[model samples]
Target chain A: MPHISLPDHLPGITGLLEFSQNTAAPIRELTQILLRGDNSLTQGERELIATVVSHNNECRFCTSAHTAAADLLLGESETCEMVKYDLDNAPVSDKMKALLTIAKMVQKSGKSVSPEAITNAKAQGATDIEIHDTVLIAALFCLYNRYVDGLASVTPDDSSFYQYLGERIVNHGYTRLPQGYDHLKNS
Target chain B: MAYIKLPDNAAGMRGLMAFRPHLAPHLGAFTEGILCIEDGLTKAEREIIGTLVSKLNDCQLCEGVHGAVAACYLDDNEVLIEQIKEDYKKAPISDKLKALLNIATSVQKGGKYVSESQIQRARDLGATDIEIHDTVIIAATFCFFNRYLDGLGIDPIQDSEIFRQRGRMIAKGLGYAPKK
Candidate 1:
């Protein structure tokens, strides 16, 4: 029921991305840099940020995708789920919990992220880059979540599909995803 | 009152840009790519999209900056900017622009809020696919931009003249690339 015609196989943002390479290339690059690139914030933590925002936004596809990624890196679905449900009580380090609080604030409104929030994060050993990445991860996931839901993209009921995608992304990263559909049309 | 150490004169995202000069380039590149780079939508139209979304997000700083930038291309009509912000549906604008604004508004609420009928309405009003596509991206990007500026507790400039000056620079293709 996507508003636009999308390939049945690709699913969610992947299918929509295949529709246009002009924008997709940059989006893909940005995702790789934001989620998978070199940063003090581990890939697992980054994915957890995205997962939390997606969960807050109630975006099923994104939440599922990032949840799987977080699960892969953290090696504990329970931990990931706990973070999603309640970061305050999650067994994560104090620094991580503080960062997640900031992420939640970003999910709600930038204005809601108060001075106290930054102070708390810093006290817990959150660096400027860590803080910056947390904000960007939360902000960018808003874009990704909205884009996928905006198009009415298809979401698979099967959880394994997302697990497979999560493993592939963890292994090869966001860069190697199929670029576009011109090849599909020719075939 | 800033949480993060920021330049004394800089405000909003600009202050953050000054604080972290290294990350500024990438953000500038993305902003330039989206707003400065010419595509199907005119620069004024794109600015209008940005301004509209900022207003929707209730980020006054962004609404002022982008609205003033939009005004540079729009003959400095402050009234029109106010009108568009207050109520774009009834604003004195073309049907196509109005339709596109509707799409942008829906984008501000959430992507899922955008219905098939909104796309059809824009198309019916003669908006091209690229125009619609750009509008969505512009709106979506503003959500990020607005959040970034506000999340850090950056204050908005009370002086309208400053925004007008910044707007002129952006309209002249300086973009958010930061002052060299």
Candidate 2:
């Protein structure tokens, strides 16, 4: 059971977000801009970064949700799994590998991210904006992971729910939730 | 000095936010939403939560910055702020605040460390649902801020007076708005 009463139909961050629309507005906007907005990094690549951070944090809901989104965006499922299991040999480019390295370090602790990681990322052609986004994405997921799990929000065990969520995220992005979900709030 | 080439005028997270213009406004709005909006928890209590989380994360910049904000709301009660930082459990705050701070401590350790009993204890002390929710959000958000500033190796400003001045502005409703 969740620590606070939440909508049963919506699970994970979605349900929690619905519970508080005041904070949700800005959080939704920020996530939309970070993951879906115009940038050198593709939406799929940003989703991949979110997946890596969630995976490292052991947040099942976030990991599964973003992994599904990344899979659909990238048009493949194996890469997300491979990145989770062993990023070193994952089929991603060396640049992605370098960026993932920094993301993982940020997951451990901000201080654990060494200067060499930044140097390596730049060497791999990661621009200043790319490096900055990677760090922010990683840090943001930490907040998400903790928020979801700290409240003990609902985490659906059904894989089909994630598949639907994946499609929704890929098509609609993060700003707006599906209609009719409003009635579920405060219920 | 930060590892990245951030703006020279802005300090700490301000410089980082300045580096990326696109994302700064939303982030600022989010900060204002959580900290400035006084619904259940007072603004001072919320800032205390942020200051405590930053201190636990060892982010000196955030601790001092937010600590100053909390102090400003408390009528310059720097001593009380220090007491809360040192140990909110023994501090002269309300039982409700103590319960909330306990939850904040668990959150700083890890997400799952927040036990059901902790929630029960807080609720027992008259903390509403929104209060508990905002506490967790505030604690979690500071983790984001701390890591963002520290991961880039931004140096913390040393002078206490600087934070005091900034605190006055923030308490006066400057909030997290990006500097023009």
Candidate 3:
């Protein structure tokens, strides 16, 4: 049960956003721009960054949601799990590992993302845009994770729900998610 | 002189954003939207939330700069800003604002920290849902900013006058647009 009443059947932030459209607009707009907008990082990589931060923050809803998105785009779930479980042990590239390391630091404290980490990411071929997006993705997810968990929104017991939503997200994206809320209601 | 070499003139978070001009514009726009755009909270109230959260995060640079901005928006209400930082509950502010600040502090701790009672209190004190939402976003965003600036090892300005000047510019709706 959420701390406050949200629209019936809506899960996590979806319910929270539906509760107030005014607050929802900017947040949705920002999410679209950051996650799906033009950037050097692929949608998978960006979603992975979000997943890593969400995991670190211990937000199950966000972690599961973004993990599904990452799984779809990357064509594998193991990569996200690897990044989530242990970045170093994950079989991602040197560059990706470096970026994930920076994301983890951001989850701890923005100040914790050190000069050495940036240097390491750069050395591994992370561009300025990539670095910027990585930070924003990490930062944005913190907001999102807090928004969902803070409200005490319902986390669906079924894992397939996330994967189904993920496929829908990979096709249409955040703007469509709100409309899908109504469809979810009808269904 | 931190993780990345920043321009001498680019101080604090400005310096970090300056390191990447491409993303700088978006951040500038977001700040403008959050603080300058006419919305649920007055510009001064938004600044108050920003300043208070920065103070809570122990981010001197953000607190000082936003305090200057809040001072400008509040018509040089320096004492009020000081009061808010020291103890907003007893501070001589409207109950609505105090309630919003209470919510902001909850955001500062963690999202899960905000309670239904707090929301109900803000609503009871004439705070609309939009106002409460904006306060939470402002507080949460500052956490990101404070951490970003401090994470990058950005330091506060040595001169208070600089903050005053910037505050005036921001108050005049100059916003965070990066100059060419």
| DockQ, all models | 0.59, 0.81, 0.41
In candidate 2, how many Å is residue A18 off?
Answer: 1.2
Interface RMSD (C-alpha) of each candidate?
1.9, 0.8, 3.0
Stretches of candidate 2 off by over 4 Å are: A178-187
lDDT of each: 0.82, 0.90, 0.80
Candidate 3: where are CA atoms >4 Å away?
A: A1-6, A15-30, A37-40, A176-181, B5-8, B13-26, B37-40, B176-180
**How many steric clashes between backbone atoms does each model show?**
0, 0, 2
Once fitted onto the true fold, the runs of candidate 1 whose alpha carbons sit more than 4 angstroms away are A176-187, B178-180
- The TM-score measured for candidate 1 stands at 0.91
Model 1, A61-174: lDDT tens digits are: 999988999999999899889998977789889999999999999987778898889999999999877887788778887787777887778988899889987897789787
RMSD of 3: 3.1
Candidate 3 residue lDDT tens string, A73-108 = 999888999889878989788998988898888887
Which one is best on TM-score? Answer: 2
Best-to-worst lDDT order: 2, 1, 3
lDDT of 2 by residue, B1-180 (tens): 576789889988778877997888889989998999789999999999999999999999999999999999999999999999998989999999999999998888778889999999999999999999999999999989888989888988999999999999999878886656
